[model samples]
Target chain A: MSIPINSSKAIFPGLITREREPVNLEFAFPTLDGRITPAEQFYVRSHFPIPEIKAEEWRLSIEGEVEHPFILTFEELKQMPARTVMATLECAGNGRSKLVPKAKGLLWEQGAVGNAEWTGVPLHLLLEKAGLKAGVIEIILEGQDEGTISEEPKAPGTIVFAHSLPLDKALQEQVLIAFEMNGEPLTAIHGYPVRAIIPGWYGMASVKWLIKITATATRFHSYWQTLEYAYWKDLYGKPTLVPVTEMQVKAEIARPALQEVVAAGSIYRVTGAAWSGEQVVEQVEISTDDGQSWQPATLLEEPVRYAWQLWEFAWNVPPTPGAYQLRARATDAAGHSQPDTHEDMRRTYMVNFVAPVEVIVK
Target chain B: MSIPINSSKAIFPGLITREREPVNLEFAFPTLDGRITPAEQFYVRSHFPIPEIKAEEWRLSIEGEVEHPFILTFEELKQMPARTVMATLECAGNGRSKLVPKAKGLLWEQGAVGNAEWTGVPLHLLLEKAGLKAGVIEIILEGQDEGTISEEPKAPGTIVFAHSLPLDKALQEQVLIAFEMNGEPLTAIHGYPVRAIIPGWYGMASVKWLIKITATATRFHSYWQTLEYAYWKDLYGKPTLVPVTEMQVKAEIARPALQEVVAAGSIYRVTGAAWSGEQVVEQVEISTDDGQSWQPATLLEEPVRYAWQLWEFAWNVPPTPGAYQLRARATDAAGHSQPDTHEDMRRTYMVNFVAPVEVIVK
Candidate 1:
């Protein structure tokens, strides 16, 4: 059978249409403003039809390696505690269109990422309330979404969207069971009454449309974890397939868009956003003359823990008119910087390479 | 250093810029007319700068595994004999932009092909005059153009543009050593003085800028041959590296233009061209609904050996206003039709798969 692609026809104002059935959308990067992406412009990634979910009838179950297996109504969970954190959520396959070998996946451009303020109950509070038993290793989160994968690395049969996080990471203060986005109630398209917001990792790790959570005594290996989202990680020259976990340091140009034309000798504000996994972005460099030379761009604001850092460069365009290729690179506090080319340790995932935006200076 | 791309600043009425240093040009296929592409409209594939050669001072050397290792002046080569053949010349990587896994090479669209009437002397006549040795296995053709390779599978150092043909293939009467193109003396860019016209083979095999010919006893393995133009051919399931040869059976649509709009319920004449390797095209099929259904297109003229066969389809359009995808499929006398998808045998080359031309009826 011909492999299925993200042929979604869904569209939203100020957003780029990506896929339809599940309603995937992309932000119009060049039109972006400020740090937080508008709710209507935030990218939507769905694997199955939006479930007919209702907040009044919903319940969350905490079971398995726990002292007291229990259920909490949506109201009960929301009444516990409310905390908000600004974070960047990026699809692991964000820059899929640029992958070499034309790898299969959603042909997402540079808009598959966005920064948002999420408000929800701390996951640790619920876990502490349920009381963990001895030898708990990981927490498996399953969503209400279910569908058959029709692309490569397909499933054997019907499958549910699920992901597991190591218990140590799950106990962090920032992990949340989000029920609100940007201070507003989550929309039906954005996982409505419940979702897991996992900061510092790819969006796939944060299962949406949350239904149940299971504390396991051993490391969990879901099909999505081992097959599709996995990439070849080299260990001493040997390629090993490992699950893609974190978002590598990446910066993307948002102004003077690809192939945009500007008058010669004009002062243009070249601005963009940069983000990294676990570590905060510390520096961003811009190259106006392709990659011949580079200059540091000043950060618009101080770096945040889990949010994207915005940067800008004021260019003094030369009088001569010609085509100029612009590119940006970001480095995190941990010293991880975006690579010029995708190393062999990739297969349509973690494509945080530096992308060029060619503009015609006329 | 990064390898050069189609960085040419040259612009013509309708020709698409491909490469600058080599002055490679691509035809705007949708605006094409008639069987023979105009001289300026013909696709030009150059490996290096147009060599500086004067017809009064130029000479072609025929040597190696032959009794007469002599040279032929431009006037001598032209006075011997002249014949013209309307043949199709394709860049092997014509549909390179659509290759999956985002393979690297040229990101050519569907314009790197055209049919031209080549005028030249039959190569067999010159070989007979130079009496070949019994051990000769191949005829090596070299052009005067030279450059250093900086791309993947690059040459170890500076290399000349070269290719070789099998002994039997070289003896074919259709192969030509030509000094004229479209009834005019060859342009420096197309190949001045004399160049080999290799009918039925990919353009790379038809080396440009004629300089010398060597009849070799051993199979030739030039860098352009074994390293770049080679693809992985599967024997059973094991991949074996093989040299890319003749053009594959394929068809492409030209009319209605891509994304062109027309009045609803109008009678539309969809036209295009189809060609194959040695086997002549026998049939051309049209799909108006994106391959779900297909109808045979009327061949405008009988198929010709090594030349593109023009085909047209008249459709009574539906009254509804919507977008429609148009694609063409061609089959040769050998029953080889364009594959729906590129099998694993491809690696940025031999991208002769069926391509769609989407149009809108408003």
Candidate 2:
């Protein structure tokens, strides 16, 4: 193989593509331009085909358990007081490819995430317009994308997609019925016309190509919605598995491509990104001598309450050529960092280990 | 605006296009078959421009602070002894785009990371050939890409570009004088021809377009090496910044698209990615009621020590239409979970807060 010698100025944000579930993959980005991931450079993660929703015909219906079940056109939803939020939308399997023993999903090595200034009407606003009825505890979200559900597994298997959330989350002010991304109308690949913006949650909860809403008293069960995405175990060597719902706190280094050499006599800056589903990062520390010592890093200020934070540190050249170890630790406001190992956890789907970098000085 | 109804496909790897920092863009990947990110789909992150180093012409000079300054060609380096490793290379600021208050740097929102099998001669193997000298405590790396370090910043006023690493880090067995990625010759965007593989550290420390390596006893500095990439903070109410050097523990949701609507009575799966520097993930927990509670998630095994882990969870729908809150938290073997805030910490750059998601059930 020949080494590429030219660095193209092509716009980024189109993240590394990988296989679908059971084999997805993500890559570590090397740029440290600490700013918004330009619309042209945001990562993309699609499960099926990129849906192309028609903007004019898009109609969001607010029905089901509400006193007022009304269907609103795209224009109607857009006119209901626009709210803008700079939020980060990440794929639940953004870094699946880097897992050990391999995984049964996309082999992503990072890059399945993106952040944007989303503009839309609040879901609460629409919920309020529909007029909620008492005893309405669950809200259902459905996408226009369709498939089939089967009792037995086939090649593609039978799975229709649908998800539901408790009424409390729908009431949050930040929950938005977004129609635009980065100040523009949603791209076809993104949930155009209408999509939910649930800040701080895994991307799985956010349905694309939204179509219907139904209110019920029981629970929901769809193959794609439940069976495939949930966390399950073989039941101590059995074939029985369970479901998964939330997210975890994790981070990654964003600079220095692996196996690349640095000018032996020069200095370089180290940077990365971090986020969690339930809390904000409290502090980040660095260790150059493996885990023997640690140092605090500088955290960048963020605009939204439920968003990831940027971090940075500096490293000078070593006086001799040898081997070195790199490690970073993050402490949330509640105090959390990566562990030395995760042997005790049973379901090995979400691995958030303390990151360590090993490199050569010369 | 109208919603474009279409199918979503899995993301491809290695096929991403490069863009300016703070990238925000979209891509419609065409897949031959429905596979997870294939090796061909993997993206690449190359610091500096890719180099055109001919195997015969390329010569590695290890001088300064060494017993005997030695120079060897690629053939010579390979002849000494060959070692290979399966490792993951990550960028320091892979998700920097998610940072709030929007810092002035690359606006990467994930997609800046990836994992691959690497083949190369270990740094130790090369060092044994050159022979280490006394008083050399640091290793300075310089790439072949030629460009003046202009005082003028990419922004109105930003730091220059130069990078460095410690000798100890440079000599790790994982650290390699790599020439291949994933069993193939390096791609241009990846360090083609020849590059260093410093596993476990930020991508920035692994300078691309290799040209020079020097052993030294004094601190090294460069545009990207010293001035830029370093962290700063208030030292006793004063602004103090330092260079970034290590990786952090972080995670991102991958499966669900934001604002997705599911049909009532459906089961949904939630998935994402998690990782840290040096430490392994112990457990990943998800919450549906903000931070009030959390449940464990299914973890995915990884091949390399520095790679990210995939996680999944399944949720059953509540028959009623309402709102739901989604959250995820990762615990390291050291017993750390996501944080609720970052306010308590004196520093703010490395925010590893647990992320939260809001979903509307109706």
Candidate 3:
């Protein structure tokens, strides 16, 4: 069967569209309810126009900084031992619109994240067969998607989408080279043949439409790595530009969407998802009294690393008829709580702060 | 006789009240006109309750790192060569409400800025009389007002509000130890006894209720200096925390308030003010076509050094009825233009970006 190019449109009815050409979509956070986001309703983030790589024609190449290099066909890659995992993929710029002095990227509003279950061959198994060489610092995963940077900090010409993972992260048994999502073969728009699911990191680490993998002896820095996905960190007491690795501690209220109206004196179930990468979100607190105090929300399930915990807060509305603001704050197991302020510096990535929703009660 | 403490309340009639105890006030931007903001309508920002330092009882101490230390009472400070200059005092955190996630500080709109004719003693003459010692790095300016920081990144008990300026900035002839605002003596709420007017810096640099002036041989690091007013800057390729020095190039549209409605086919005279600290705002541009295209606005007066330039744009609205966003951007002589987007980091202060005002046409 022939693959469809740029077919992500119209299929997902509920996603908020930011860009049409590159197919950037945010999930309808107010509509979807459940721990696992349905495949049809999952968000889509594309660096370039969706490349049509047929399943039969695709081959995964493993080379560079390895003792033995090999290429595996789609069927051969699928023949290897497989594993299934549930992980959340959050774009680094998910809650960017919430930042004051809104940054110059897609005006995303806390919906650019979704959880999914996938079946794939463990990447470490493939890496074991390839036999990583000594002194290897990174494994660069490349995607078939190629495009030129059109915005500020513009790059020269068309370049392929690529990202590198450290040896330890690549060797993690749960990291997958997946071909199926939610019990079905991957849809063309969702990286059909194979995609690397890099758990515990921002979605950018998971290179989609996997085509080639190169184990590098030195740190691999690409346009997306150093320029786009990088953020300022205080490394050694300096505002050092470092590549974004882990997802920040964040909680987003999905139910009772922004600027909604509700009845006074009614129990509004404030529901949302709290997530962190590598770290566990220990508590999700809801603030209905305009942040003077907070009430702990009930987590629907036990904390899972690299996955979002579904949380609900039963907020009994006061009988007073007035406007109300609902704010959710998530604190990770590492004691990192969400601060509702922005640093003076304004880059366009990694916005994990708490954003509030305003509702009028009548 | 006793001096009244924290008496900056209920004096200013039209000021938008954010906090009552500390008396944080924003000017009614849409209501005021003219270059010099009226004495009764000026904006006020206080770290603590307005200290009522009576002119008779107030003492200005000019001590530390100096060949000759001296003290001056309010009358003595006013006797030392007074100069009147028109300058704009803008809170560094102006327009913070426009930030997406809504920061933790008082949600200041564009009204947290005002231009006034400040008459005061040139600080350089005072420093000249004190005879600066060699190796003096910074001049610390202290206010009589003291309070504990009740917010996040909270500090210890009842600290005095103070800030230090680099030696070069302190030596500028226009930096004031003034006892007068406009043609009248300083108002009770606007630093009753004496205040500093740091031209080309945010209002925080202009200490109110001035009580002490200290010269330090090394970097004078204080709570407000390093913690509150500091921002992360890429120093020597590092995101080093640096004190926020100059006001960023910013323009605020006052004529067309946010979310206003107007006639479709009428001429709308969009007016605003543009000011930059130390930097000369060369041009002010307005975008009526949703930021896709920008048109230059007419600067009403010559560009003042440290004062805002009033500007107007005559827009011939289209006959068709629809919604439109109006954005104003300023470019300084240094070629630094206002960026529409924010960087990723979120700190509490210094937001000088272009914010749009939405309007509907019928």
Candidate 4:
């Protein structure tokens, strides 16, 4: 039976949306305040309607390349010691709206990302209990939410939203089967009862409403892993497909919002947040005069692994009143930084260019 | 009738407090995430219980040194063009807890500061409508909430929370008569119908539940301004008293909270926020190994006029496991930076000293 999609909740009061059916928080809301996006205001990106599963009846199955395939009930899973981590989840197509010739998916602005404290048992511990085989090459996680992928006729008619990680990534100590978000039980929209928290990866890699985990001896290819969520690049005049996995470094202005007006000769505080998927953000710089000169913004708080860092800069408005452009760029510990312009890719999966916010000084 | 102080509503879920009879939002909640503190989460520093004023009956009186002394109804006030500003507010006794002798009143932590988007008519526009007199010396703002101060038996039995700003500051366009906060009408606890937003002054200067604005021919010296908020200091062995007004530069770490344990050899982001009352923060440096060496932190956004700017630094945990001391200091536009230790002042009003956050690595 198909789960009914409900969009009547007012959890997020002023959430902007590109698509209403699956629900998406506008790019401006999360950055408006605080660091951890409250669970109620956490962004929801679902391909299909949410599935309702009774906690008592819910069971997670571990099959395939395991020496002992087993099923664990929700209560049984909770009996283990839980680890908590603050991780940021961003849609693969977060900045697609900024791309020219607009990308064909959910045209998200920057609001497609949020950081939350997740609590759960480590996936590696569960994997160890399952007794993984030496030849295992990949681990596939499947969510209960299922729907027909009409866009891909060649794929199975109906399949669960699923993705796979290489054996090394799947066994990382940071990966977890999360049951709580921001100190509260996960809401239905955020995968109640159980979900997978794959730190440092795009939102797609962390399957919600998780139902099954399968260890395989060979690389697993699903519609999401092979057909969608991958960027096609022209390398030496040849098409090469690369899967969108970890998030690239990006920054966004939260206050003095786009097109905001300020009094001339007044000092205004400009602020925003920045994040990198797999590595810590090393630096974030703000350019008030359209990149002609750059000044460093003070980073707020200690960076947590898999969490975005908040940043700020002080801009002295010129005595003369007119339009001014503001831009922010972030660099990660991996030595990757945002480029000034968008890359020419076949798909707009990760648009990490330095987008300018225009402000008028009156 | 005395205004009733209601605590039935939980606007701030985790508000730390020194007194419950008169509400006060502790200093740590506002820096949790984002830039603007949400209306519900905005810190409250109230002396008397919130006065319940019917919106229809509420009137703001503009009297004293003006050609035309007039009263404005709520509707009339809303008819004027509204100006929105993201300003930071902090209690004058914010760092009183750090005082050695234990300063009188609330022992607030760093959470007393918050940035909010306030919307209302500019004070200058309203003053223009009132037609200011040629020699107006001060603008006195009076809130409706009133209570007897046991500490000042020589003063009036009942006194309203009142303060005055200089003529130049009162006429500044940044000063606002705010009625809306964070896109919603103000709550009763936050001065519902009207409150003054003095961009760069201490929270006392921005009187809440404001009902009167008086332009005085002579300097207005209220108990709040002259006796309570003033800091007694020793200048050349002579006792001198100075009014607490603008905020001094301060920095506080917001994440990996104090005494948090971190994994060794892991990359962690160390971040915090910094602010100066009237000037912009010019620099913020972080020292992981005490004050021996310092590295510049990346500021996240442009420095706001009266709001704190978030900052970050990537801290690479040393491979060996042990305790680490992290310290952050800020410098403002005037070249006035935070001191290594607290100033030797008789009163603990403004404490702008570098604070170290201790953490253990395992």
My TM-score estimates for the predictions, one after another, are 0.50, 0.45, 0.50, 0.48
For model 1, residues B69-179, the per-residue Cα lDDT tens digits are 889998899889778888888998888878766666667788899988899999998899999999998988888888876653234345678888999899999999987
Q: Fraction of reference contacts reproduced per prediction?
A: 0.00, 0.00, 0.00, 0.00
Question: Which portions of model 3 show Cα errors greater than 4 Å?
Answer: A1-362, B1-13
Docking class of 4: incorrect
DockQ top scorer: 3
Every candidate's DockQ is 0.01, 0.01, 0.01, 0.00
Model 3, A176-286: lDDT tens digits are 999989889988778987999998898998889998988877656565655567665431122334567888888888767777677788877777798988888999999
Candidate 2: stretches off by over 4 Å? A1-14, A20-28, A148-159, A232-245, A342-349, B1-362
lDDT of 3 at A163: 84
**Candidate 4 lDDT by residue in tens digits, B44-139:** 899889899988999999988899989999999999999898888888888677776565578887778788899999998888999998998788
- Residue pairs with colliding backbones in model 1 are A8-A19, A8-A20, A9-A20, A101-B101, A101-B102, A102-B101, A102-B102, A103-B101, B6-B18, B8-B20
Cα deviation in Å at residue A144, candidate 1?
42
Candidate 3 chain A weakest lDDT stretch, 10 residues: A1-10
Model 2, C-alpha of A197: deviation from truth (Å): 1.3
Q: Which stretches of candidate 1 lie over 4 Å from their true place?
A: A1-362, B1-12
Best candidate according to TM-score: 3
Lowest summed lDDT window (length 10), candidate 3 chain B: B1-10
| lDDT (tens digit, per residue) of candidate 3 on B29-58 | 876466788878898999888887678888
At residue A352, give the lDDT of candidate 3.
65
The RMSD of every model to the true structure, in order and in angstroms, is 20.1, 29.5, 17.7, 29.4
lDDT digits (tens) for residues B1-362 of candidate 2? 11122233454433445463312222212221221223454445543334566667877777666676777777776676667765544565555544554544455554555556667878766566567777666676656654332221211122212355677887778877788777788766565677787776666676665655666665453434323454433222212224456555665555444445544466676666666655667678877676787788877664236666767677665678776667777777656555665421212234457655556676
